[model samples]
Target: MALIAIFILRKRNSDSGDRQSSNQNPQGLFSILNLEGKLVYDEIVRATNDFDAENCIGNGGHGSVYRAELPSGEVVAVKKFHSPLSCDQIADQKEFLTEVKALTETRHRNIVKFYGFCSHARHSFLVYEFLERGSLAAILSSDAAAQELDWSQRMNAIKGVADALSYLHHDCFPPIVHRDISSKNLLLDLEYEAHVADFGIAKFLMPDSSNWTEFAGTYGYVAPELAYTMKITEKCDVYSFGVLVLEVIKGKHPRDFLSSISSSSLNTDIELDEMLDPRLPAPSRSVQEKLISIMEVAFSCLNKSPESRPTMKIVSQQLRT
Candidate 1:
């Protein structure tokens, strides 16, 4: 009986040690939250009133969005996803694990910061730092915001997105591909710095992974090659980023122009000004040179043959120049 009591005490001690070590480790987000700070789940519930319908910001292919505030009086955006268990079990696990894994491990200025997540039998949600300006899509969609998005802001924002993508594709150990790179996924802070979001979730969402049931992207942003080919590669993201860059400068998606250039009948070489968004004036000499190079790189990324497209590292270098 004494021996049994000793064994139970030992087990309890071991369990307590494990818990204490976990809290001390500079990993598993206990460290990060200590640095930039953490938004407690209970406080967030109060801020958004438990994600009341009135607080909803937007809806997406997989989830609904809500705006919440932190104890520090800072606002944030949270995405609450519908249980994929109702539709596809495999996808639910992959997407939840993918975003959670990617954000937990990676951190950069251009990358969106993941505060934390909550997953239970009834609720699944991700918390992210809020951008006062909201998505690039919303800004461009509004007449006032589009008008205010001047050339300088536009150029910087483009570089911000490029830098973020480059980090994901080259800087990371295994590299990450942001399967979704549309305007909606690019959010800007008050200073107009762009942070890429909605990354690391794509393949699993496709029913036929080998050959996607469909292109699995916003209509205009989907790479042209996806029309005939089903294979997904990092270049697909490069292609999408290229379109996104042009869209930022042009104040809209560039589907018509992409189609025109792709047509066998039309000459690929066209005046850059011809495609400029009318809202913005012609680029300055330096800006013009930069825009020309960017457009060329965009063209290369949009190449129908995925092999022909330059890797994002190369694209990042070109943008820096």
Candidate 2:
């Protein structure tokens, strides 16, 4: 690991610059390796223009993300967080550490690559490999972008996310539960391939611990069980994944549709074609049959009882078949 110490006398002229820089800790520590740490740091700082609003691409619960191009002509996503040394920023720091920890422990093709991170007294930021297509939510929200994501591409996205979740839940030494999994957290590359991002609230499913914690997930994406019990498990992520798959199939959130299907009074024999996004043409027969199977797996993940949800490994294998 490359450790570089630098002084941050100047801060971004933004709303996050409320606290004054202190002289006691003249130099802030930057943890990144082998990529010319100081030079990369300087390039990122200059490229972002002190994290100007124009460079910002998106805002999330944790921090604002900026798009930056290094001198090497490499484009990257820089997530500039609120100050970490301040009292009010304690929670932000914990979340930042959580992301760093989670990303460092696991790696997969369908997971965003963490290039480096800076934990400065005046400012904190994480660098990630930039994806051209942006978030799944953003693309699905746009008619043109959604149309570009055809039936095959959509299926690939779902499979990619499932593969990543399987790696996290089963492959890792101490299995991880992504407390937050939503369309917004799933990014898409140029080919519309899904890459899971944002691990601010991820927790390790330590066998000894009950893993009980406060609710931490996107409103509609969170599992229903979280509302009644804080005890978190891998199943919470499964439920969120189920919702995401439905969102990918249908062009929007499936809240009303899911509720209607849950009721025995409503007709349950909904056609697979009817559930697909209307912006694109109907899929081929083979694709339609595969989609039907995928839909079945997704609905099973949404089972009210957490124990009934299939393990991510099973979901991944089924999708592959």
Clash pairs, candidate 1, are none
Clashes counted in candidate 1 amount to 0
Per-residue lDDT over 1-321 for candidate 2, one digit per residue giving the tens place of the 0 to 100 score:
223232223222221344321211222223243345433556777889988999999998779999998787889999988565344665785687568767877789999998877766556788899999999889989999999999999999999999999999999967889888889999999888889999888887777677888878888889988889999888999989999999999989888877775522334377886788999998888989999999999988888889988999999999999
RMSD of 2: 6.6
Reference-based lDDT, residue 299, model 2: 86
TM-score between candidate 2 and the true structure? 0.88
lDDT, candidates in the order shown: 0.72, 0.81
Cα TM-score per model: 0.80, 0.88
Query: Which 10 residues in a row give candidate 2 its minimum summed lDDT?
Result: 20-29
Q: List runs of model 2 lying over 4 Å from the truth.
A: 1-39, 261-268
| Model 2 Cα shift for residue 6 (angstroms) | 12
Q: Which candidate ranks first by lDDT, i.e. highest?
A: 2
Q: Between which residue pairs do clashes occur in model 2?
A: none
- Candidate 1 Cα misplacement greater than 4 A, ranges: 1-37, 84-90, 200-215, 263-267
Tens digit of per-residue lDDT, candidate 1, span 71-143: 7878889887766233245455446546766787678898899877665445567788888788999999998
Count of backbone collisions in candidate 2: 0
